[model samples]
Target chain A: MGNDVSFFSNVLYMASNVQMIIAVLLGALGGVFVGFLPAFGSPTAVALLLPLTFLMPTDVSMVMLAGIYFGANFGGAIPAILVNTPGTPPAFITAIDGYPLAVKGKAKEALFVSNFSSFVGCILGAVMFYFLANVVGKAALAFGPAETFALMVLGLACVAGLSKGSIWRSIIALAFGVAITTIGIDPLTTVPRYTFGKIGLYSGIPFVPAMIGLFGISEAILLLQKGKMFEGDKVEEEKALNTKANGPTLLERAKMLPTNIISSIVGFVVGSIPGAGATVAGMMSWNLARQRSKTPEKFGKGAIEGVAASESANNAASAGALVPMLSLGIPGSSTTAVMLAALMMHDILPGPLLIVEQPGLISYLTASYIIGGLAAFIVFQLSIPLFEKLMYIAKPIIAGLVFVLAVSGTYFLRNSLTDIYIVALFGIIGYLMKHFDFPVAPTVLGLVLGGGLESNLRLALKIGGVGELFTPIASFCLLLALIMLVLPTIRSRRTRNEESQVM
Target chain B: MNRIVGLLIVIVSLAYTIGALKWSLWTEGNPGPGLFPVIIGIIALIAGVMCIVEGVIPVNGKQTLIQGLKWSAFLVALTVLVVFLMEFLGIAIGSGLAFAAVLTAGGYRRKFLLILIPIITTVSIYLVFGWWLHLPYVWIQ
Candidate 1:
């Protein structure tokens, strides 16, 4: 009670500052705009905008950047929902169900649900961060290399659930992705293992460009492959769009509030863990919602609950990622890592002492989530119709836009043409993978976690050999991974046996 | 086709695992760069063999690989060509050409749209990413 009162008091105090308010609004608006652009994720936007903040005061800049961080979560969902192209990797989960809704002419409902859930997620995650930041930060700091490695393994093992095809294919895809990550100079010994004498290979295949190719370019190719078949579906969708709005009512949307809150909590916890990003949070929450739902078959087939679960979790995870960064000087994701650098650039050190020394800054940052969420929501709501029109655009134009943006976004990453080649290569690979029914999500998750997994494994071995895996948290993660991998197979076998017996 | 893909995966994983052996598996009594890759390679190798076996097993119905390959190959060729052209024509012009080519390939028959939208898109992209944001590195020079 005392803490709540103090937190509310501080929030009220910061809310009164007009400059702070303006900064949050402006940053959030910019964030939404960039995020709405295909292929421009939050990390790129924040990295690009960081230079502009050098002229501003530390508190103002921090709040503004934080606002952008919060808002990008909302903006990334637009492309994912309207089209099947995810602006960020995590938004891919939103596209699973959200795009189907758009195809069903329920784009308005999809966007509304996404935006509303994001708003709820932000507020709830902020409240949780305020209450548990210190505790969560301390727990996160306790993670050693073994625990981190084990957690990553657990994350990778979720491929069992993520895969909708042959398990062997998913495993191969994941291993292939991990192999690709090993191309760079080894973190442990600085030895280039698979560079093949190319300068770009020394740094390994960049993940973002690879993502752009996998999702964006590959989608374009798939759409083009359909030709007349795709046009037929598009015509039906266009007709559906013109006919009537067939979606869940406002009350039905309201019924998902509990789901939003639950997913937000899940996202917040996952996000607080160092290096466990919004993608993992979104994946985990979507899987959990499927497990808990009465109509599990509706998942990935236009379930509104799927969109609600994923959007809320990803947004809340963005907010929750701040807990470790603000409290313990550890960043949980790439965007927060950049924000940490921004703080250090301003000579504002973040750690245990940060809360005591910079109460106003911390309070203002937490309060900005609500403001930023509201700003992003209003902007998105106002533009829902415009965003939905993207669905009606000619297929050729959409394909061209995806190609240009994918290529351009990859180029902007490091101003390297090598990345463009990487995108092209992955574009072909992704197309083949999709055609073969191999799940791409596992490959993505593996790529994202591969470097960390290796570094942590080597570090843990040095620290304690195999004994490191015996630690409580590490063992718990291994157990969880085992359960995640085994349970589905067992269930499927049981169902098959029962069917055979009935027949 | 599944058998071929599986065989390719097997060959690649074998090569990768062998390549990993060139690097030390352990250094200074700790695991080295080769360890992780070797583990991954082994997993992939096993999975590939299983995929191959599965592919060889006869199922209830005939499995057919669709004819989606030609269009995808065309798109891929265009992508490579556009990137190559960007070196000489600049990103704006290269992208304009790409837009026109892709639109035509995707069966857009309207002549005005094929001509006009590409120019508009090129100029708009340049203005936003090149002039205003100072992003998208190379423009003309």
Candidate 2:
């Protein structure tokens, strides 16, 4: 506790530096700018700027990047509330109630709740990050190969749970991703596996190219297919929704404090679990709030409580994501995984030893989140009218700008043509998957978890004296996977039977 | 399309499993190269079977196999085309062309998009990566 205070004081002192302040401000501003734009999220932003971080001190660079992350999270809600477009995956749920509110001529109120909830959620998450750092960090370090493998298995099973459509298709995508991961050298042995004698395959499929192809290019294709940049009806409605501001009064806002607190707590707990991110947090919190609301039916129609619940949950989830990243060195989402990559680039491994070795860094990071969150709140509050104007921009221009950014970002990663090709390929895949109603998130998760699962499984086998392959933990994970695979089918069958009976 | 995709995946999984089976499962010390892949391949094959069965059964309002084919074909063509272009033009040029073509084909308008997007993208790549960060343009090499 004493160490924490000293660390906090030291961070506050460091943050007072002019250079650090400027970096934070720039990062916060940049985060909001990128987050406001569709198809550009924090991960891409961080990846684009990662190389530049080499020029700054590691602590300052991390602080700035962290600021960008929090800023993006805050900025994502603006488009979601006013335009019905989620700037990030987590903001999708925000759009559910937020858009309705916008249509109901309460756009400002919805935006206010979103901004406030995000601020509250971020502070709550930072508090959790500060308190749990020592305990969670240690547990993360103690995980062996077997435990890590089991965790990956659990993550894959969670992906199965999150898959919205045909579970079989999701499993197939997961399998394909795993197969792609195996295309490189075997972890236990130096011998190559599925490289097909290609030198590039020896190192496995590079993640950046695959990610760019899947999300960025695929999204571009889909946007084109939709035939217009923005939906005409949505644009008309938004124009009408942009009426005079009649936001909540200070007392009215104060009355919702308890709800924000509860939602933040719920969001943090959900976010701490791997593969469970802001989307789930938002959905869960919104549902919980609805169930507890006096008028549940008002949720989808334009409920301030619904907006608050979703925003709080999503923001908290963003913070909660850091828990696993900091403690277990496991990323809770794609964005966090990218942050992990950035940390690795800096040679700063996050685990049990992180806090002990660099106590000040954790405090610094925590302080950055607080500062970033505050900065985001201030920026959003001041720039609501300006951001609202962005809705009028033509879709082609926005898409064009996004395309340029994605292209440049991919090129900067490795300058490899293969990477660009991979991005295009994935982009097409992402587009088609959307058309077919297959969830794209699981595919990303599968890709991210694939190498970890493979390497750890091999390592655990090597460590367990060969015959111990079927240890209790391994069996437990396999059993869990089996149950996850089977249970969904059974549940669907049961639901169908019940419906038939009712009919 | 659903049945074809399912079948294709199954075949791929089978092929991979066969290859994995041929490798030593274990040596004196290290785990064998095939150990994890073979298991994954087998599970994938099972999943493929489930997908094929589901495709044939037509539970709920799922798209018909033929409907799936159109999308699958378009995407596969796009991917192959992009890969081909990448070999000749390099990442930036290839990506810009691919992006413009794909977007336009998808129904995007504004002729200026093709010109403006590519140029801006290329220049940005040069400034941030080549000039600012000092990362080598490997594709150029």
Candidate 3:
């Protein structure tokens, strides 16, 4: 009863706060705009706008950042539908059906279904996030240092599935990320490990500048190679789906609801797993929906259900991606990793204790997410034609804007030019990694989690000797991590074998 | 290139482990700093070995390396230019040159855009970071 009263009181406080409302409104607006631009996915978008949050209170900052993340997920579908170019990986699937629908003069139907699906997905994701994060957080109260160490190991093990090239190389990348984070003065001992006596290396590396480099500057490098991204858009003249009453009424589309529900659940589940982001969730949900559809032939050919499936799953996945980050201090996606960085910067550490330590902040964040989603729906659904003009904006212009944001955001952190240099160095590293089909996400995750991982391991080891490694909970968690790493490779091999046999 | 990367990883990991050897492994019941590094270094070594083996036995076609080298080079040069600007000149020149250099690298050759946009970008950064956030980024000082 006391908890309920406090929770409602917090809600009432947030509801009356004008600044919080404004922050959400501004974040949603910025999210839609930045998300529509080229090479600015959710991570880059968050990293770019992160500086704005630096000046605001932590609650307001989180509200704005949450708004940006949610709005970006919805905004990416606009470009996917309009220009066959997805602003982010998750939206790429939306293009398969959405662009075709647009070409068939039913763009409005595709867009509407997509937004509706996204709304449903966001609602479902929020529900899952609230319940699951709370449950996970509570369960984690039973965890000791050994269990926490195992959890970090499990988090690192998930990097294998995220690798675009060789899993081995990704492991190397993860190790390298951990190694770099272990630089500067040791937390246990005052002795420096890899600082090599440079006073500049005192703080090791700032996650913000590293984030700007990995996501922001690397994006600029990728954009530099592609010439004229918007030039290929085949714009067509079509009437609005709203004006055309002959088409499926909102009620008729409501009949096609099973796929959307399934996709949302799938998305939420996939997104809850560390390292399995929205893109995979969208793709898997889309394929599953198609497999179950009566008119499988209609897929990839302007099917409204396809739009419903992918959009629902992707948006839910985006929301669900927050679960691991908030509950276990393990970021489920790149955007969440950056969000974790933002939280840490503001002296708010998210983990099992977050529920008890900062329940009011959590309540505000959860409310902001819902409010942000609604804002995205109203913004994107009501103003499709307005955002269509964004498709005509030149790629170079977007590149220029992002470039400015990158340098400014990096430099202003602690007012150090050294941050900019760090951005440059990591930018080059990110470029090479992307160029060679290596994954950058794992490294960032490793770096962010490395400090906690190190301390936890040391604590567990100190309390108990080498025997501590064999604790029941720790061993169980390690086995789960091993299974998570091995299962995907085994499945892939089996699929390959089946394909070869069929051939 | 893949072989070289794998070799580099192995070398780096080995060197790291060797350097960690100087630190005390364990003190009484407390685990020293070296223990964690040594364990991580071993994992790194295994990963490196795996990468090297994967590089040695390849079945698929190789993708081209040095993708769009010229553009990447120009972008790097532009970043360096900003570093020089910040050191020699001030924030105005640094940010303006950086923005201008980025535009040029992105194939923005329009005279007005090249000249005007950078100034706008620099000014916006100045007003926001310096004025609004109240950071100490002096434009001319």
Candidate 4:
């Protein structure tokens, strides 16, 4: 009780103080601005701001980063609502109902519902992480390489299953992603695998460059192909929605509480899985809410429930993603992976030890969620009009700017020309993948997990004989992975049979 | 389209398999470096074959063209231009020029805006990535 009181008091102090509050608000603002741009998700926002954090106190610095992470989800919903395009992967689900609502001149209402639901989700996720940290954190320590390998398999399978009819394409993309990481010198032995005798290939593929290329440059190329950014003649209709008074009343907003709560719960669970990330969590939440909705026909047709379901789930997922990283030293999502890297840079080893050693630090970081969520809501509400105007920035201008940023942002990471070429190659690949109806998420996630998966598999086999793979934990995870892979196919067959009967 | 993509993947993975076989596969009880690559190669091959099979499967639903893009050729050209320019003149100038070029390609003809937008963009990038972030390169100057 004493620790709880101190924790709450410190959080209050940090949030109430002028400077820390300003830092959080400013970080949230930057997050929103970055999140509004295509391919500039929370990872980029955090990566860009990581250097600045070194200058501040640990608590303030973490609070600022927390603000940015939470703020990004809110910011992503704006462009997704206003434009049919998603700024971040999680926002992809938001765009389904969001764009339609914007088409119906309910942009402000969607924005309001999203922000409000995000707050609720943020609160629930924070509470879960704080209370469950002691129990789940311990279980996480028992996971070995075999377990991790199985988990990665499950992650990839889930991605393929959720590809929305592009399962094979997603699988191919995932395979290519994993294969690409095999280049450069092999970690186990010094032998180079796929270098083709090039000196530049010795250091392995840079992660950030590939990411910026796959997401940023591909986005630019896609925008160029689309010919225009936003639909014209809808400008006047959009203007009507921009009116401050056009938002939903408090009572009407309260009605969506049920959907928001359900989606948030779903988001929290999905996010707890390593590598599952916000995209799946949010997607699952949105789908579940839609299924449970009384007026199913209203979904994907300017439904407020869609915005609530998506926003709540993704926001909650962010906090859930952190639980594993903070406690067990495993990254639940790529964004948290980046955060793990950042924490390591600060000489803080993130595992069970840190939780016991630095209880105050952990509390401060957790408290940032509550404070950051409120800050994000305030910042997003104030900046909605500015973001809408950003939507109108000339299509070519945005395309050009995105291309420039993608290239330069990638190059700056290592100052290597090889990085530039990788970005270019993957940028083209990404564009083609987009053109070919191949989901890009699988490819990126595969790349993120490639090194870790390979090394883990080898390490597990090295430590224990081949039989180690059959440990109860590893076997259970592998069984779950197998189910993930086959269950989708079975479901699709069942759906086909049911349709045939109906016909 | 499916067959073409599938064939491309198969060919690529086949080439990779040949390269990987140069390394020893199994060393003692633990697997060697080549083992992982072999597994990756097999996965690629399987996915490629699956792609081919899926292509042949008839569908009653809408089929969107995956690789059919009228602007693809132009987009490729723009990508090449940015990459090449980035090598010679540095990111700021290269990106400025590429920005103008892409704008023109996208059918934007506002002469002053094109010129002004690039300058502003380059300056902003230099300020953020160069001056503030201390990245190694942004402007040649």
lDDT of 3 by residue, A135-241 (tens): 64445456667877786677577556554445677777788778878887888887788778898897788765775576556766666655433223312222332
Task: List DockQ, one per candidate, in order.
Answer: 0.52, 0.32, 0.42, 0.45
Tell me how far the alpha carbon of residue A296 in candidate 4 is from the true structure, in angstroms, after superposition. 9.7
Q: For model 4, what is the C-alpha lDDT against the true structure?
A: 0.74
Scoring only the A-chain of each prediction against the true A-chain gives TM-scores of 0.92, 0.71, 0.62, 0.80
lDDT of each: 0.79, 0.69, 0.71, 0.74
Tens-place lDDT digits, model 2, residues A29-141: 77877776555556766665566567788767776787788888888787677655456667756776787888777888888889999999988888887777666545445
Q: Please name the candidate that would achieve the greatest lDDT relative to the true structure.
A: 1
Give the range of the ten consecutive residues with the poorest summed lDDT in model 4 chain B: B59-68
Comparing only chain B with the true structure, the TM-scores of all models are 0.78, 0.57, 0.78, 0.68
Candidate 2 Cα misplacement greater than 4 A, ranges: A1-21, A34-44, A47-65, A72-121, A228-364, A380-399, A465-491, B56-131, B134-141
Better of 1 and 4 by TM-score: 1
* lDDT digits (tens) for residues A395-426 of candidate 4: 66777776766666566655666666677677
Q: Which stretches of candidate 1 lie over 4 Å from their true place?
A: A1-23, A50-60, A228-234, A237-243, A344-347, A498-503, B55-68, B135-138
C-alpha displacement of B31 in model 1, angstroms?
A: 0.8
Encode model 1's per-residue lDDT on A251-338: one tens digit a residue: 8978898889889998998889888878888877887888889987678789888889988898888888888988888889988888
Rank order by lDDT, top first?
A: 1, 4, 3, 2
Q: Is the docking of candidate 4 incorrect, acceptable, medium or high quality?
A: acceptable
lDDT of 2 at B60: 24
Model 3 chain A — which ten-residue stretch has the worst lDDT?
A234-243
In candidate 4, stretches whose alpha carbon ends up further than 4 angstroms from where it belongs are A1-5, A51-59, A76-118, A228-314, A324-353, A497-503, B56-90
